[model samples]
Target chain A: MIGYLDFVIALALAGAMAVMLTRLCLGPSLYDRILAVNSFGTKTVLFLSVFAIMVGRADGVDIALLYALINFIATIAILKFFRYRSLDVALSQMTKRIDQVEGGQ
Target chain B: MANLDLTQYLDYALIAMLVVVGIAIIRMKNLFAIVMLTGTYSLLSAAWFVSLDAVDVAFTEAAVGAGISTVLMLGAMLLTARDCKPEGKARHIVALLVVVITGAALLYALGDMPIYGDPNSPVNAYVGMDYVAMTPNDINVPNIVTAVLASYRGFDTLGETFVVFTAGLGVALLLGLGGRKEEEN
Candidate 1:
């Protein structure tokens, strides 16, 4: 039945999450850890969807969509911060370029 | 077989994994791995909340705990050293004792709590039921959580949104991303 499928999918997601946890705990490099966290976020989104089906609350899908968007933004922010040292520096540099373009125009 | 359901089994498994992950996080010395594990922990907790049928709470936890906090912590880690300094044995022991006592007190308090998902619990019998019953008539929204959060609790949500805005503004100011840039030039 549909309920059995939901249970199976949830169990599979949980198992995958367990593996990601181990990778996170034992990751040798920072990149590995970052990758693990990103993968875990993906799994969580899928898990939330499966859980919505299990509970018969289709509205829970909205939360899953929110999670997906937030997770993408967070990962991008973390990477940008890591590369630029300070987010302010990045923002300032962009604004300086914009001002130069305006002056040229 | 008679006592256990699929959801209960899933809950127990997830909790067991969470405890292991928590211990691993504490034992690890690498700051990056710790941050990553913290995200995993948050996701697990959010999943657990979903299992408990607290969709709104789960949503908040997933967004804030797993998403925003992880990015913030990563930003902090970038500004700090990657490795944690070893603590004194005495400090460690004191911290451990404090944690144990607090955890024990919390467990003791749990005895007075209503059983999980009990229909007759005061929470379910009162305001929770009122919200569920009236939500359909008053709000006409499919998702009661959204209706309550956006309409019934509009002011509180507004305050929360402002709090997030203020925090972002503070971060921008601290990082010199605000009007200070013009002053510097």
Candidate 2:
């Protein structure tokens, strides 16, 4: 049942996806960008699933599931990185103080 | 494509919602607002899939788009800065140019595509139909989505999972612990 309506829907999703792109450009925090990217991933899963339907296949659902799993893992990794980065920054500041005291001697 | 009298009406509504929700997600300044909108966008998209008569696809979209993506977004937020850095003029110019070019390119590509659900398109006549028709017999999963994901496309899914795992591991390894204190350094 291909129709003009489906095309409009697809394009609209594409437009919505474009909004996510805006977040990549204007996201207030780095985390926001990551969230936006994850949103994009979910949209992609939806898009592929729709395309699968468009092609009359059951395979798109399968891909979407895989994508969901992937998106979660990615978020986990990014958080992990952020946690470490902050700790490192703290350590560096302390080291600088120690070095200054020692160098004065 | 299967013969739903209400499908057209639903499809149009769904697409409209998708566009509106997407705009809201992008324009809202609050991080939480964006997250909620994104979820809504996914849910709306899943509903759109259902209207397309791809029940399996619809189910998958509902699960991943509605459920899992939000959880990930929340997790990432804990460590990330609360707000984005203000944009510079140079960056804004670059972003506008990129969006305009990419949008133009995509619109051009759309013209060559087959009409939505055209049976003669290679997508319909290709191996996808074979998977849908025969997957039930070989894999016996009533959910063709599952059958293809776990069976025919199992290997690819595995690779994708590995990528996710790697992303997590990298974040943990690189961002989690890589920042050494001065003492450690």
Candidate 2 residue-wise lDDT, A14-42, digit = tens: 56666776675466666677677678767
Please report the interface RMSD of model 2 to 1 decimal: 10.7
Give the number of the best model, judged by lDDT.
Answer: 1
Query: Which structure among the candidates has the greatest TM-score?
Result: 1
Where does model 1 sit among the CAPRI classes? acceptable
| lDDT string, candidate 1, B11-114, tens digits | 98789889988999889988767877887888889888887777777876776777667767877876898789998899989998999999999999999999
Clashes counted in candidate 2 amount to 12
- Per-residue lDDT tens digits of candidate 2, residues B1-185? 44244356546756876777777665666664465467656666775776566665565555555545655565565567555556689988999999999999999999999997699999889898999889868988787766887788889878766655644553354233445433544
Model 1 share of native interface contacts: 0.51
TM-score per candidate, chains pooled: 0.81, 0.50
DockQ top scorer: 1
Fnat for model 2?
A: 0.04
Clashing pairs in 1: none
